[model samples]
Structures are given as structure tokens and as C-alpha cells.
Target: MAAGRLSFRNITALAPMVRVGTLPMRLLALDYGADLVYCEELIDLKMVQCQRVVNEVLETVDFIAPDDRVMFRTCMREKDRVVFQMGTADPDRALAVARLVEKDVAAIDVNMGCPKEYSTKGGMGVALLSDPDKIEAILKKLVTGVSIPVTCKIRILPSVEETVSLVQRIEKTGIAAIAVHGRFKEERPRHPVHCDYIQAVAGAVSIPVIANGGSLDLVRTHADVEEFRKATSASSVMLARAAMWNASVFRSQGLLPVETVMEEYLRYAVQYDNHAFNTKYCLCQMLRDKVESPLGKQVQAAQTNAEISEAYGLQEFYQQTQDRLQTKRDTLQRSSQPSCPVMDGDIITMAIKFERREYPPQITPKMFLLEWSRREKLEQPRYKTVQRSQDRAFQSTVTVAKKKYRSSLWEKSKKFAEQASAIVCLRVLGIPEGRLGEDDSGLVCKRKREGRSNGNSEEERGKKLHVEAEASEPAAPAEGEGPNHPTQLAGTL
Candidate 1:
């Protein structure tokens, strides 16, 4: 190759061979003497809205060393409101996002390759590929606005002619370089990769091309790269899971994997997870392909069979017995792979650093309040509305704490209610005015409904005298004094 770089299946490297990291795992951290480390490809617009989510991402990547050559990758996908409602797209949405993430990384990449429907709806991700003009506009805008190198990922179109056309069209846009995901997105699942598409696109465009997809392990990576080299006569390759899960693969000088590695893997998994089940799930995937390897040839390729059976002849369940936190089956069934992975040492360390621990997360009072409210008699507390159910209990707890702060007010209101009706009626009836005349005292009423007013007036006058006598009368005191002196009690008591 003129560039002096080695060739892999349709992927060409320009001399400086670099090791790259996969999505979520950055390339700069790996010690491949990489050209640069690019972050994952799914930093969506929603991330911009939620300061907490944005802060978490920043903290994870904030410590990027200068020599590490860190960079950010955001898929230039459609702005699906459903996907990004938590964070949405404003006219200055891209610029707003750029301001938040402090970058020491080499470049900021906008993704246009992701084909997820939610992404497309947002007018950002892979949908841009359908219109080169729009992508060029986006690229030009980003290039002008940002200070870093801007790059993009492309996919082969259904027709080779279209792929060539798209490449030639995008090539003129003046991006720093380009990479191609060889499969037509429609052929995502198990379709054969047409490596020639990469070659065609490379020839069509003058920029550097990075090849992606297909090779998952070193055994196959060697073969895949070998074919890739033969097919395109190009250099360099990109890997995801293999490079990330086993850092040794890049450093192994091509050694085949072993069961001992799996044992170490389990050790790390337990260490990182602290007995959580996620470690188990990852362990199962890592050991999935070993069945055909030398250590695995003795065993059958039974992915579903988690219990290493006598038929496969490999069972070292006792490895887990040493740790009280772990337990393993003496024998695995005739399954294809174990449900969970058990990892060891460096891999575990790498995971512990990159992957978050599955533990009881730190919570604030507000989270507890939300959880408590969810359990309230109200139709449904706000907990159901929150996407994160795990924090519901915490959020509701805070809700109740605030309620506690105001509970005294509620109790005081309840106590006053018993006398409220009588108080209100007395006020309404014009509280005693000065004299207790026949009418004002309620001993007589001028009722039109009565038989006769004059007759009632004369009867009232006579009744009034009796009413006064009764009002002036006093009963004997409780201890048998003839009567209490009203003059003394009213004046002094």
C-alpha cells in the first residue's frame, strides 16, 4: 500500500496503525497507540436537555488525558421527539449542545448512519444520508462552528451505482475523512457483507476510509482482515466487542482465547458487579464462541446449554466455590451458552472503570418524596410518569418529607372545624347588639306568617315581662348557697 499501512477486509489505513474502541468504550483509553479515541456514536439531542444525563457523560469522559486523543461522537440522526423529548432540538440545538460538553478530545463527530426510527423522526441521524445536500449543509455548518476535525460514517447503498454517486457527492463536501459501514442497512442482521462496496466507495472518494462491522473476535478478525486485505488491497480495521471486552486480543500477537481467561473474567465480573446478575449475562456472551477453540473443541457449540455437561466435557464449577458471594453449578446442561458471564482481573478493572457498578445508587430527599407520593391514595403519583422506575421509591419518599413539614397546618385546620358552624351562624344572626329587647333577644318575632300582628304585639308585651323575670331570676349555687350575686360575679368573676 502506498500509505505503508496494512490492509484488512476492504479497510485501508494511512500508515499510523491505531487501535480504536467500540461504542460506549472510547478508543483513546486503549494502548494501541491509536490515531485518536472517538467516543460512542449515540450521544443524542436528548442528552443536551437533561443536565444530569449530560453531566454523567461528561464525568465518564472528563478525565480524558491529552495524549489519549479523546473525541465525541453524536449520531446526526433525526430528532425523534419521543426519543429526545427529555432534550429536544431548537434551531440552535446543536450549538447549545456543543457549549455544554467541554472537549479536550481531538474531534466532534455527528452521526448520520444510525437507522433507528426514532432517530430518523428527529431529522438528524441516518436520514441525512438520503440527502447529500442536507448533510453537506450540516457538515459545513459544523465545520464553521467548531474548532475540531469533523468526520462522518457512511453506509453502502442498495445499488453500487448509488453508493458511488453518494460517495462522489459527499466527497466534495470537504470533510476531514470518512468511514464506511459496508452493509446496506437493510441487510443488518445476517446478510453477507459486500466488501467490494467499500472498495467502490474508496475509489469514488479521495478521503481516508475506515472499515467497520463483521469481525468480532481475533480468530475471525485475522481471517476477516486477511480477506479484507485481499479484497480491497487496503490497510487498517475497526473492531468493537473484541477490542473492548478483551484488551488482550489487540496485544496477544494472535493467541487463541482460553478457559483460564474465562475464569479470570468471572473473577472480575463478580468484583465489578458485587454479586449482581449483569456479570452473569456478560459472561455468557464472552464464552459463547469458545466451543470451537482448542479449549472448547472438546465441548459442543451449545449456546443455550449453560450447565457445562459431560457431553462437552468441560466443568469447573468449583471456581465459584471459593467466593461466598458467588455460586456455580457443578455441571452445565446441554445449552449453547451460559446465561451470565463470570470475568476476571484486568478485564474486570477495565469494566469497573468504564461500566458503572450495579449497586444502590446515591439518592436525595426529592427522590424519596416521589416514591411515597406514588403509593398515595391519589389516582396515581408522579412516579408512574418517570421513566426510571428504580428511583420511584426514592422520589416518593421526598414527597412525603415535604408533606411532613406542612402537617401541623392540616391538623390545626381540622380542629377548628368542630366549632365553625356555630361561630358562622352566630355572626350571621347579628351578634347581640347592645340590648336584649323582645325582638333582638329572640323572645319575639315579627312573623307575617303569624295569625295577627297587633294581637301578637299585645301578647308579646305581656310575654316580655315574664321573659325579663326569668332573665333576672337566679338558681341556687352548687354548694347550697341561696344564690350567687350577679353583681359580684358579673363585675369581678
Candidate 2:
């Protein structure tokens, strides 16, 4: 192995299992004794459209989709040991994705062993295995374009000679390693893995070969990992079901009880703020046949992380982690504020953010501002939002009546930043943004009261009176209408 490059020699790795190779599980695998971890395979098309975001609250780097959902999340801890496995058939799209994530991961592995229809139909995964030319093209592109090591995982062909021939061609692309899952394209876990065929492929290729698909028959404990490695004559062994069942299988001492492993996994889940549903799914996978047990049933019924933690007797840990995250968020917010005054052509701005929890469900400040604009027969509000490159935070400015308003506080999403700007505009105009009691009175109505206070300067008082006089006439419902009777705005905001 070269300096700054990943080495697969004599290592135990976690195989990339869809929906099972998520963050919490990968962290657990590393906490045990696994040498490397592969994140779940993400499609190139979906990955290409995502914007990278640095999440200060969770201390993770997030790839956010257009819908504001996190497609992938990784922290600095796994930057050197994590393998970003991607599903792609096109050489250009594959290279594009490789370059996008090259800095955040140790290596990029192309997934070619998946036999599912979704992958094959898209000319990816097992589909690429049949088209050797496309596979070579994709691999060559990644090897030449990315600075990190490149690898691929594949299922063996029916004949050892054919698989060896294919791998020999793949080795010419200069990939650092290759993983051979000892099964044919149509074979499942129930079918026995062909260790002899894997040995043939490993023998033919000079690059490191990672042996996979041994969980069902060979791998169960730490010693089995070496046995599987020797059986296939590969440089490393990757375990899927065995590690998923009990990550501590990587422990040299022995396999620990599944219950103990699950508790440790939950701590990582809570610490990382993993989604409740993903945590539950991984726990259920650990439970397997025992899902009918009382603890499993309790976990299955949980809707939130707190509930899941309670089911595992980790509620105190969950609460402490949440409180710590809140404190970190507040600190980051304060540190992110501009040291100097913010000015847009001589207009000073105030810092703000749209807190969804502070408003009634389905009601937003943007909706209210748009309605107020229409009722007063003014131009519709227009928002210009930009994402900061340093931390991927979003800031938006909204223009109404030839005046611009913006929030200095950066938001996690563009939609939220736009709403924040709208809140600033509504507050300055003395318009009710939401109901007082149902919503957070301090945030929703604080500015409305400030606009009417005697502490305002004469110039500020004149501006407020002018705006209120313009909106006083009955062109529509009054500005102070409560949340129960908000003016309906057409179309989605």
C-alpha cells in the first residue's frame, strides 16, 4: 500500500448492504474492530443533484436533495476509512460523482454485484458486469479522475475462467482493489458461495481482491473471517449479514450478546441524531426472528428517537445528547453573526430564522406576507436566496414595496431562509404573522409590538405610520387577522 492510499491487505471490512450500511451501523462496525466501512450504495443521478452542506448542529457533512432531504451524511471521523459506493453505468456521470465526493471519503467503489431489477434496468450493478466495456470505461475514468483509491465489487460468473478473464481486463484500469462476492448473478444467500471461483479471480488479478458473500456459510466469529480469507486466497474479507447481526463479530475476543450490541448501536444513533425510522429498521434487523419479543415490539411501535431510546433504557443519554446539540447550535448561531453591521445599499439588517415549531401547522410567514401584499395591491414579494460556500448555510432577501429585508442568521435550507426574510418584512410592517397563544408569542408577535412602541426614533415612527396608513383601507381582510382566519393565498409558497 502506498502512502495516503487505502490498503486492503489482511483487513476485515463491512460489506455495503442497502439500507443496512447507514451511518449508525458503520460507526458501530468501526467501534467493534472492522478495518473499513462502506456506506449504502447511492445512485449517481440522485447524487448529482444534491448540494453539499456542512451541518454544524449534528457535526456532519450533509448532501441535501432538492426536496431538502439529506441523501447522505458523513462526519470527519470516517473520512479516511469510509468507502463511498456508488451505482452508475455512465462513465461521465460516474466520474462526476467520484470527483464530488473524493475529498470526503478514502476510496470510491463502483457497485457491480447487485442483481436487483432496479439496478439492472438502469444499466448499473449486475448490468455492468455483463457489459465489460462499460465497466472498464467507468473504472478507468474514476481511477484517472479521482485522487483516492478506486475499487469495484462484483459477483462471480458461472465459470472461473470467464470471471478471471473479466477481472484481468479490470486490473488494467489501475483500480487499487476489487471485491469478489462469491456468487453468480442469479444466486442468493441461500445458495453456497463458490470460494474456489473467488480464488481463481484473486489469483488472476495483481490488485488487492476483497472476498465477500461468506456470512451465510463461513463467517460467524472473528476466526471465521480469517478462514474465509484463506479459503478465497484474497487480500481481505468483507462481512455483511454476520456484521449486521452482530457487529462485535469483528471483536477478536468473541461475539457479544446481540442485546448488548444493540444498546451500544443505539448510543451512536442518538449521538449522531440518526433518523428514528432508520434506527428502528437497523435494530429490527439485529433482532431478526426475535422481533416478536417484547423489546422488539416496543421498538417497532416507537415513532421518535426518544421513544426508541426509552425502549432500550437510554432516554437519559438521548436527552443529554439533545441538550448538548442545542447548546452547540446556539453557539454556532452566535459565532456566525457578522461582527460588523450588514448593509444592503445603506439599509441595516437584523438576524432571524424561521422556526417551524414557533408557528401553527401548515401556516408560514411567507404565506402571510404574500397575502398582505395582494390585499394592499402591492407588487408580489420576490426572494433572492444564496447559499454560503463556507458552511453551506442559506441567506435570503425579500423585496416588497421597493424595500429589501433579510435575515442575517443563515438557515439550513433555502425555503427556511426565504421565510425568515418574510418574517422580517412582516414584523417591520406591523402585520400579524401568526396567532399569539397557539404560536410562540415571543417570536411571532414580538416585532409587531416593537413597531408600535414609543421607543422608536422619529424617522422610524414616520416610516411605520406611512406603511400602516397605506394598508389601512379595506382592500381585503384587516392585517391583524388571527391564525384562524389567515387570508388564503393561491398556489404553494
Candidate 3:
């Protein structure tokens, strides 16, 4: 490897998988002795729109989307060992994404091996294999444009000679390393990997060659990793399905039981505050054929991390992690307070952000506030929003029952800022914010009437209100529902 680049020499690594290569799985592979880990392949188009955020509560650096979804997350623990992989066909777009994340990752890997339609339809992934000139341009652009090591993962061509010629062309682009998945573009997992083709490419290229695609056939155990490396004559070995099924396959001693590995993975999932759906998906992949077992059925039915923890008998661990996260958030909130307590106009402001994970899925603070207003027969809330020119962060103030509320913290989008303001109002009014632990609070604001001529049940009404709140701005106050009406305020605790 060149100076300032990650070395791919004689090491075992976790391959970049579609959904299986998330933070929890990457951290687990590191814990079990993998030399380097790769995050899942992200499209360059999606990455360019993300805003990087330092999440103090989760203790990770998050690339958050405009809708507040986490596109990619990594903590300081894996700073030097995590490789970011992205799919792109354009040289400029690929360079833009590489520049965006070069400082945070150890290296950048262009994904050229994926055969999925989603990647190929966009002229990315395996589609790059058919365009050698475009591949050279993209790789060279990244290598010369970014400060980090640039690499590419590619599938073998139809023949060994063709594969060697392609890798030799890739080497001239000044990449630090190349990972060759020893299969043709049309080959599936059931087809045998062509180790001879990988070896030919390794021999042709002076740069380090990382061999991949030998999971179920040649590489089943920890010891098989070296066997696969020797067979392909490559600098290192990368595991996907083998590591997905059992991350401890990287352990030199022996592979641990699937159950033990699953339990340990859940611990990391909870500690990192991973999304419940992702955690469950990784667990199911580990289960494999055992997915038909009773425990598997229970895990399959789980909708939340807490439910998954109960299935794995790790509820206590889950609760402790949640409690620790809450405490960290509270401490950070206090630390963000201004010492002089300057007032914004006449209303006092406090720091707050709308953390989507704290509430149930598809539920927001704005939805709760809207339901409350309708229940009390008060006018709908109105919001005044503004976006900062320099950073594009938005701040909003929402009026409920003639009282205006706003958060000191600016959010990434107007919707999030409005939700933050609603949170402040909900807190001041002594109402539950409908967080996960609040009992029946989400249901309290629903209509009490059992029957309606319009045929909208309580659930239906709540869903309709949620849609209206999210899709449109707050409605204007009625003629008599102005601030001068002097309505009774909800009592504070």
C-alpha cells in the first residue's frame, strides 16, 4: 500500500453488504477480530444531499438526510478502520461524494461488483464493468481529488485473460488496492467462484488485490479465510455471507455459536441506538435456516428493539442502554443553555431537537399537538418559520392557545424545527410528548366518540390528522379564535 493509504496485505476483512454491513455488524466484526470493515454501499446521489451531524446523544457522526433519516453513521471507535463504499457512474459525482466523506473514513471503495438491478439500472455497480474508460476516469478522479486512498471492487469478466486485462487497466489509475469478487457479472451465489481468474488478476496488478466471493463454498470457517487467500493468491480475503451468518468467523480460535453471536450483536445494536428494523434484519440473516424455530418466530414478530430484546432475553440490557442514552441527552441539553439567559423577544428559549427514535415510528410531536387542539375545540396552531442563509438551518415558532413556543436549537429542515417547537409547547403544557415509555398518551388525544356518521373511527381520525399535519402548513385561526379571546390555558405541572 502507498503512504497514507490502508494496507490490504494478508488481512481478513468484512465485505460491503447491502443491508448487513451497517454499524452494529461492522462493530461486531471488529470485535471478533476483522482487520477492516466496510459500510454498506451508498449511492453517490443520495450521499451528496446529506448534512453531516455530530450526534452527542448517540456518540456517533451521522450523515442525516433532509427528512432526518440517518444515511450513514460511524463513531470514533472505527474511525481508522472503516471503509466507505459508494456506487457511481459519473466521475464528478463520485469525486464529490469522495470529498464529502474522505475526512471521516479511512479509504473510499467504488462498488463495481454488485449485480442488483437497482445499481445496474443507474449505470453503476456491475454496469461499470462494461465501460473501462468510464471506470478509469472515475477511479483516477477520486485518487487525484481526495486525500484518502481510493480503491474499487469489481467482478471478474467472462474469461481469465479478460479479467487480468481489466484489472491491469484499473491499476494504472493509481488506486491503492482492488478487490476482485471471483465471479462473472451474471454469476449468482450458487455458482462456483473462479479462483483462477482472481489469481490471474492478482498476478497482473502490482497494487494489492483483495479476494472476495468465497463464502459458502470455500470459506466456511476462520481457517478457511487463509485457504481462500492462498487459493486466489491475493493480498487479503473479504467475507460477506460467512461474516453475515457469523461475524466471529474472523476469530482465530474458532467460530462461536450463532445464538451467542446473535446475543452479542444485539448488545451492540442497543448500545449504538440502531434502528429496530435493521437490527431485526441482521438477526434474521444470522438465523439462516433456523428462522423456522420458535425463537425465530418470536423474533420475526418483533416490531421494536424492546420486543427483540425480550425475544433474546436481553430486555434488562436494552432498558439500561436506553436509560443511559436519555441521561446523556439531558446532560447535553443542560450544557447547551446560555449562561446569561438572554431572551428572544419575550419568550424564553431552550435547546431541543426532534429525535425521531424517541417516539414510536410514524409519530411526531406536531401530530400530537394537532390532535390536542382538535380535542379541545381550539383553533389550529400556526407557525412562523425562517431559514438561516449561511447554514440553511431552520427555526420555527408555533402558537397554541395564544402562547408561542420555540426551541433554541435550529434544525436541518423546516418540518423538524416545527416539531421541535411543538415539543417545547407540549412540555410547558404538562402533556406527555408520546415518547415510547409514556403510557396511553398517544391515544389520549383521540376522539372519544364511539360512533360517527362520517364513518371515521378514532384510529382513522388520528391517521387523517397526522396526514394533514405533515402535508400542509397549520391552518389560520377562525374569526373568534384569535389571541384576544382569553381562553383557559392547560395547567403546567
lDDT of each: 0.37, 0.82, 0.83
C-alpha TM-scores of all predictions: 0.44, 0.74, 0.75
Stretches off by above 4 angstroms in model 3 are: 1-4, 339-348, 351-403, 406-493
Q: lDDT by residue for model 3 over 182-262, one digit each (tens)?
A: 988898999999999888888887888999999969999998998999999999999999999999999999999999999
Better of 1 and 2 by lDDT: 2
Give the top-scoring candidate (TM-score): 3
Q: Highest lDDT: which candidate?
A: 3
lDDT comparing candidate 1 with the true structure: 0.37
Q: Which candidate, 1 or 3, would have the higher lDDT against the true structure? A: 3
Instruction: Quote model 1's TM-score.
Output: 0.44
Return the lDDT, model 1, position 16. 13
Candidate 2 on 364-438: residue-level lDDT in tens?
Answer: 677578768877889878777666543346677788899888887877677788788888888777786873344
Name the 10 consecutive residues with the lowest summed lDDT in model 2: 483-492
Model 3 TM-score, all chains together: 0.75
Q: After superposition, how far is residue 278 of candidate 1 from its true place, in Å?
A: 6.6
Which candidate, 2 or 3, has the higher lDDT?
A: 3
